[model samples]
Target: MRRDDRENWRRVSRRRFIRLTGATLSLAPFIPLHASAAAKARIGVLKFGTVSWELDTITHHGFDRENGVELDITYFAGEDATNVAMLAGDLDIIVTDWLWVSRQRAAGEDITLIPYSSAVGAIMVKEASPIRAVTDLTGRKIGVAGGPIDKSWLLLQAFCQRDHGIDLAAQNDIVFGAPPLISEKAMQGELDAVLNFWHFCARLEARGFRRLIGTNDAAMALGAKGPVSALGYVFHEDWARANPQAIEGFARASAQAKKLLATSDAEWLRLAPIVKAEGTELEKLRDRYREGIPTRPVAEEEADAAKLYLVLAQVGGQRLVGQSPEMAPGTFWEGMPK
Candidate 1:
């Protein structure tokens, strides 16, 4: 080959390489990045909380990644620890009741809540007990979980007073204790009736205890239009505003996980070990969890919460509701980021 021809070929090759590189660079804006490159959110959760069920489902199904967020989970053994972590800025999110968020907001903390579950406690008694009516509970020993200001117990008191003309706190022998302790004592027949959390109530139901009255029933009797969420995913409003994508993505992933759990029995079976339930207990847990999933609009939930807040204030006094006689504005976060 001639030297001139070889030089011409080398120039053409270099020109072709530069043109291809420029074309590739032009297409760079159109190429999608991997999901791992998305935003990250740090969430604190109770080690054995029901929230874990939904979170596990999200992780297993890659819902977070699909929604453009990566979840960084930290587990705590107690609710107080998780709350502390959240308040101290160690976590971006935590699950808690909206009442607490309202109290915090009333104190000027600027936190807000998104609905998680409407499940609440119930007045439970053994299947063979003769406590067929609220009147029958008069003079009976009642074990209450979450102390005197517990929302369920306070609601029950208001319900009884209005519907049956009975003041439960004065008429009954009230015993306050932790949820697990109260549940165990109730199982051992140490109390005539027990007002306990929803999960404990489900366990008692599986063990043949009868739900004398659910908190939902009392709420309805007291004028709630539908189920009211007692608990939700709470976070700082400032943080939510700053990381809009992360916050909204987490909410969407959470909702998808709830939908999956609501429909798939196989998902529940996969969660059996974590739930520590089997047979009837598993079924009870599954059904109760499904029932707890929040489906109502945020406006409806906030409206119901406002009504219930007044009821709680009447029964619980300033100690329970803090300085707020009414639920603080922005207690229930409206959907999506602004």
Candidate 2:
């Protein structure tokens, strides 16, 4: 062949090799190999509790890196504040209270429930106090972090009213307190009781505080057949739509984490360090996890709707506005791997 013809053949061969390489790469793990090659996104989370674990892991471990994407996370105090930040467009994705998703939707804000994990709150009181039963809470002053829209407090009241025929709001004074203040106030005996989630309640229990009730128990009492829950992941609607791959990537990582927790005691032991509460009270943390992490996301529409409406209605003195209490939208996704 002439020199010019040989050179033309080599150029064609190189172009074909490049095309085959691109096709081969595309057929591999789309996330683990592709997303990280793209761009990094931020995931916002609420810092108050153990519920932030999945996003926290994603943020720290490059939830994006495993899937080929980059992730950054910011933590906030409570769901209300987190929602405010989400609405202001400060977050790419977020994990927040599932109940707040509906509350935000009812108020005409658009957000979705990503439903990554599950947890329940417990009612804590000092062991030395005379409060041995939920009924004993009737006249005691109770402290909760968020005002009325908080699901646990509302569920507590519903369980009390529905099961025992006691009107909690009319019977006990419900005070909204900051997260850090609950332990101090409860220990000081200034507050008769407080509703707490995860290790905070565990801390109280470790400190000789008696738990008159757990949110899970209350959920069963309210006829929740499976896991009655106080916690899950919430994401902004627009943010999730634009960042679907990010959501999918993070969800895949979280499902893997859940499977790890479920199958391996070793993994649980490993996580025990990170999720465990610090201080001498740490034994309480072990006990709390031993009870089990539900990890099942609630349905967006049916299962969680009434719960949200009931809680929010009790808060605002309205029943989801124009919508009937019996019907509402489910905002969460299903089909995460077990």
Q: Give each model's whole-structure lDDT.
A: 0.92, 0.64
Of candidate 2, the 10-residue stretch with the lowest lDDT total is 319-328
Please, what is the TM-score per model? Answer: 0.91, 0.74
Clashing pairs in 2: 31-67, 35-68, 35-69, 36-68, 36-69, 96-234, 300-330, 300-331, 300-332, 301-330
Best by TM-score: 1
**TM value for model 1:** 0.91
Residues 112-213, candidate 1: write the lDDT tens digits.
988999988899999999999888999999999998898988899999999999999999899999899999999999999999999999999999998999
Model 2, CA-based lDDT: 0.64
Clashes of 2: 10
Error (Å) of candidate 2 at residue 248 is: 1.1
lDDT (Cα, tens digit) per residue for candidate 2, span 125-207:
87778888887877879888655645677777788887788887888887887666877788888899898766678778777
Point to the candidate with the largest lDDT.
Answer: 1
